[model samples]
Target chain A: EAGVTQSPRYAVLQEGQAVSFWCDPISGHDTLYWYQQPRDQGPQLLVYFRDEAVIDNSQLPSDRFSAVRPKGTNSTLKIQSAKQGDTATYLCASSSDSYNNQAPLFGEGTRLSVL
Target chain B: GDSVTQTEGLVTLTEGLPVMLNCTYQTIYSNPFLFWYVQHLNESPRLLLKSFTDNKRTEHQGFHATLHKSSSSFHLQKSSAQLSDSALYYCALMRGSALGRLHFGAGTQLIVIP
Candidate 1:
């Protein structure tokens, strides 16, 4: 079975530029999540959706970051105006709704660098 | 609020030595799932082990962890380390209600020297 897939494995941009990351989760998975992982740090949850409905996004930066899962299978996270602090890896993960014991699987992540 | 804490940023040990990576968590949910994920260089993080039952040990790939509700800890341990064990380890927690939303710790980098 194919795992979660993310496009543009790496991205470099200047400050104030906008960028978008895409994610295609595993088939049949009901939950999708976006996380930011700074260098030397663990993944931090940014936003999550269950079947096209956002479950939580309190940690997301409302001013600059936005995410959507229109079809409940694919997702896109957008940064309106990137900053130096936004230099980090953007990870996408997914899990099924079958059981609570199921663990989320992650993608290779998009390594973003803001100059 | 939910959070995970891994105290060790870097741990270096010779091959065949015992390994212990500290992990602690705080969450308001009564039954939270705890997970250990390992990431090799240039690779995605994969599940190492996970457990929700308090005090019941879960083992995988020679690594083991036990979730202790009394102390709010789920420290990862291995009796002997190998060179192939070198990688980044993260401890994470998810509230029962928030199925896929995981709160991860700062992570611990383990370097096993042969």
Candidate 2:
């Protein structure tokens, strides 16, 4: 089976610039997640959804970060007015189903560098 | 208040030696699921082991981890380290009773020097 896919493998942006990262999850997966991993750190959960409706996004920075899964299969995580701290890998992952039973399959991730 | 802590930032070991990476967690919710994920260079992290029951060792690909609820720890172990086993390992917790978000530790980089 095809794994989760992410676009724009690498992105370099000036501070305050806007960027969007896209993700296409595995077929039939119901849970999609977005995580941010700073250098030398583990991936931190930013937001997650079950078929489009966000389940948790408390960790997402509302002022500059926004995400959407309009159709439940694909997702987009956007960052406006990016800052230097936003330089990291944006990883998108998906699970087979909810109830927290299935292991997540991750995408290669979008490496973002904010200057 | 829920978080994970992996004690080792980096561990360098010779091949064929026993391996161990420390992990601990704190969560108020009941019935948490512990997980270990391995990430190779330039690749997305993959699940290596997960457990919900205490004292039962979960093993995969010769790597194993036992979750001890009493100690709030899940330490990953391997009998004989292989060069291929060198990677970044992350410890995570899944609060099954709550929203079930995967909370992760800062990861341990294992380098198996041959």
lDDT of each residue in A1-115, candidate 2, tens digit only: 8999999999999999999999999999888999998877789899999898999999999999999999999999999899999999999999865554667778999999999
iRMS per model, in Å, is: 1.4, 1.9
Check candidate 1 and list the clashing pairs.
Answer: none
Candidate 1 residue lDDT tens string, B9-112:
99999999999999999988988999999999877799999888999999998999999999999999999999999999999888764574788888999999
- Number of backbone collisions per candidate: 0, 0
Error of 1 at A48 (Å): 0.7
Docking class of 1: medium
Query: Following a full C-alpha superposition, what root-mean-square deviation does model 2 have from the true structure?
Result: 1.8
lDDT of 1 by residue, A1-115 (tens): 9999999999999999999999999999889999998887778889999989999999999999999999899999999999999999999999887655468899999999999
Model 1 lDDT at residue A5: 97
- Residue A11 accuracy (lDDT) in model 2: 98
For model 2 the local lDDT of residue A106 reads 87
